[model samples]
Target chain A: MNQNYSTVAQRSSSVLATNKVLRNTYLLLSLTLLFSGLTAGLSMFLNMPPMTYLISVISGMVIAMFVLPRFANSTAGIGIVFLITGLLGFGLGPMLTMYASLPNGGNIITLSLGGTGVIFMGLSAYALATRKDFSFLGGFLMVGFLLVLIAALANIFLQIPAMSLAISSVVILIMSGFILYDTSRIIHGGETNYVLATIGLYMTIFNIFISLLQILGIMGNDD
Target chain B: MDWMQIASALALGMFLIILFPAALQMMKNSPKAAPSDWKAVIVPMIIIVLFIMLLIKLV
Candidate 1:
């Protein structure tokens, strides 16, 4: 009886912990989205470019992300959020401008958001229900991602539309795998911290959303 | 389709990829009731913030 009770207690505690992490992550994610949208609007109002400078900024931001995890527990995390928000805001300037300038700008945003929503709902469900170990995908996805990056950089100078579209498609696929992998990690006891899980899941969602937007832009002329 | 959107997405995507693992590692290694010190989040955050500011200003 004592042993059974201990097991029950352990299970309940873990469930409670998972619930807490999921709740916090969702709250923070929403807050980040709100801030991102606001910054995007502000940048558009300030007449920021939709390209060039954003590329450089993003490059810098990527590099910073590498460095930030080393300081995850400090007040520095706040600074990291500020930086991410700023970059995200700047990044949105172009979309914001396009949306405001084009007749179908709102459509583009809506479609992108909707597409992201669908992917998240579908992939997350799969992750939760499926029994396959997605961690095996980490290596393959990394290789594919590297190739995509190289291809993307090469295209900047080569100026190939087809190549860009192809890269975007692959990115969408790769990021989806990441979502499955990350979520499964959490479910399988591979990831125990909600903060970290949130970051992983957030990245997966962010990429998936952006890639969907790219695909929509390439295939649909509604915007 | 536009260059800016591509660049922005790429930048955000890459940063999160790097941070996600680090955040996980931090959590995994941390002890209960004494979350490990996260001094590592500074460099990337500051770098990213500066970049974002610059992007906003220059773009």
Candidate 2:
């Protein structure tokens, strides 16, 4: 009986720890987004070379993403969190330059944020209410992602604006499915590592936001 | 290559990396245990190689 009690205590403590990590990840992500936005805004205001800056930042991100996860053991995870967020900020540079400079830039940014919020709320609510295991979604999402990737690359050469819109829509859907699967994983005790969970969630949100921004730019009236 | 192009490529690379390992592990029926041993690393490595080749062609 005593052993069982101790085991329960241990399990509870772990759950608490996971929750703490989740909270911290979210706090950090918010701050990182703010920092990235400021950096992009400042660069655009200064008329800096956005492309070169973005490339250098993204190159570092690619390296970190590959190397950091393998060593996400202690402060390593925190360091990775900052690195990935910084890269994402850099990724936003070009778009920020374009959108912020335009007369209707604010609208595009607003629409993108709204779309992201809607996706997060809708998918998160569904995951919480249904209680159905969404583990199967992982596979379907990957297949969908591959399809989008091929389509996106094809459009680059084909120069089809319509195809780009279609791909963006599909990418948004796939990322939403990922959000569901990832959130379910955490709530169901499937993902014990908070840093890994944050990484997964961050990717989903990042993809969704990017797609949303693209779609809004293409579809919105900029008068 | 353009920044937009590079960004897209990077995103794809990250997706492939996460997908390969997680999918292989999911294929196994073991609930708590990850399905792949070191033996499974070869498959993802091959996929990454193919992905890099494709990315090179695109760029």
Candidate 3:
């Protein structure tokens, strides 16, 4: 009887801890997303120049890889996450502007945004509902990410439209995988740091949105 | 190559090289737990494919 009581208590406490992490991660993720959007909107309003690829990549790497990890256990981590997301968002302004310039650009943007939202919600809901341990995908996702990164970099020099489309397609798949993997990691207690988890999920969403936009843009041009 | 091309190449090369080892390290450290349900993986992938098809049809 005593053993049974302790087991119940332990399980409930574990569940409560998991719930707290989920709650905090989602809360912080929402705020950082909004902050990113605001910065993007501000950049658009100001007609900021398109961020050069090199600068965006370098700055993104510096913040995400170098800075965020060091501060991830501290309160300052949240601020650094904001800085990374905001910079990426500002970089998005010019891309959005370019899309808005197209003939059916507004429609394309709307469809891509809607599609991204649907995919993110669907995948995340599935992970949370099932409470699955998707950690096995970590290895596969990392490889996929590396492949996509290399292809994207190569396409920059190749300037091949078809290759760009292919890269975007692969990226969408990889990002979706990341969403499942990251969310499941959080639920299963594999990841306890909400800040790091939030950033991972945020990056996944960002990549998905960008890839969808690229695909929609290409298809719009085709029609 | 021009300066811009050179810089892009160098940055991209460095990023990729750094990423490879980092990813390996991450995988090494990740928990070695079997997935609870394969359907969780399959369903999301199917959804992604269908969604992409829908987007392609939209434009």
Candidate 4:
């Protein structure tokens, strides 16, 4: 009887802890997204020229890979996450402006945003509801991510429009996969740090939105 | 399609072919939680399809 009571107590406490992590992750994710949006808006308002892709990508990687992990356990982690996201948002200003200048650019942007929202919400909801352990995706996701990165960098130099479109399409799928994997990780207690989880989710959403916009832009030009 | 288009399609197809099997295997092997109502999953998928269609129409 005593063993049964202790077991029940342990299970309840674990559930509570999982719930807390989920709540905190979502709360932080929302705030970071809003913060990123504000910065993006500010960049647009200022009409800032787009930072060079090499510089922006390199700096962003440094912050995410090095700075984030180093400071993820401290109060400073929140600030670093904001900085990384805000910089990314700021970098998007020029691209947004370029798109807005195009005919039907507004519609394209709106559609991309809508698509991204639907994908993220749907995939995340499925993961949370099913509570499937997606940690198995870790290796495959990493390999796929690296391949996409290499392809993207090559396309940057090759300047092949078709390849660019293909990369965008592939990235859209990968990012969607990431949304599922990351959310499942959070729910299954594979990821305990809400800050890091929030960053992961935020980056996935950002990439999906951008990839959709790129695809729309390419197709629009063809039309 | 042009050569570039053909190449692009091939690349995308290859990646998807490799990825799909691995993902399915992972899903099969992973320990699943208590099954939730299928409705929850189906509803979101429908929404996603509709949303994609909307984007295609816009493009």
Best candidate per DockQ, number?
3
lDDT of 3 by residue, A1-223 (tens): 9999999999999889989999999999889889878987887788877644346556876789888999999999999988888888877887888899999899888898889889888888988988777888887789888887788778768889889889998888888988988988888888899999999989888888888899889988855
Better of 1 and 2 by TM-score: 2
Native-referenced DockQ of model 1: 0.06
Model 3 deviation from native, Cα RMSD in Å: 2.2
Q: Candidate 2 versus the native: TM-score? A: 0.73
DockQ of each: 0.06, 0.06, 0.53, 0.12
Root-mean-square deviation (CA) per prediction: 11.8, 10.0, 2.2, 6.5
lDDT of 4 by residue, A135-204 (tens): 6556556567767866865664577988988888778777766887788787777888888988889889
Q: Write model 2 residue lDDT over A34-99, tens digit each, in one string.
A: 765666566566666656455645564565567767867777776777677666666577776776
Among incorrect, acceptable, medium and high, the docking class of model 2 is: incorrect
- Docking band of candidate 3: medium
lDDT of each: 0.60, 0.65, 0.84, 0.75
User: Distance (Å) between predicted and true CA of B51, model 2?
Assistant: 34
Best candidate, TM-score-wise?
A: 3
Residues B1-59, candidate 1, lDDT per residue (tens digit)? Answer: 67655665566456556645655554455333312212222232344335323322321
* Model 4 ranges with Cα > 4 A deviation: A52-54, B1-53
- For all predicted structures, in order, the TM-scores are 0.69, 0.73, 0.92, 0.81
lDDT measured at residue A147 in model 3 versus the true structure, 0 to 100: 84
Can you tell me the CAPRI class of model 1?
Answer: incorrect
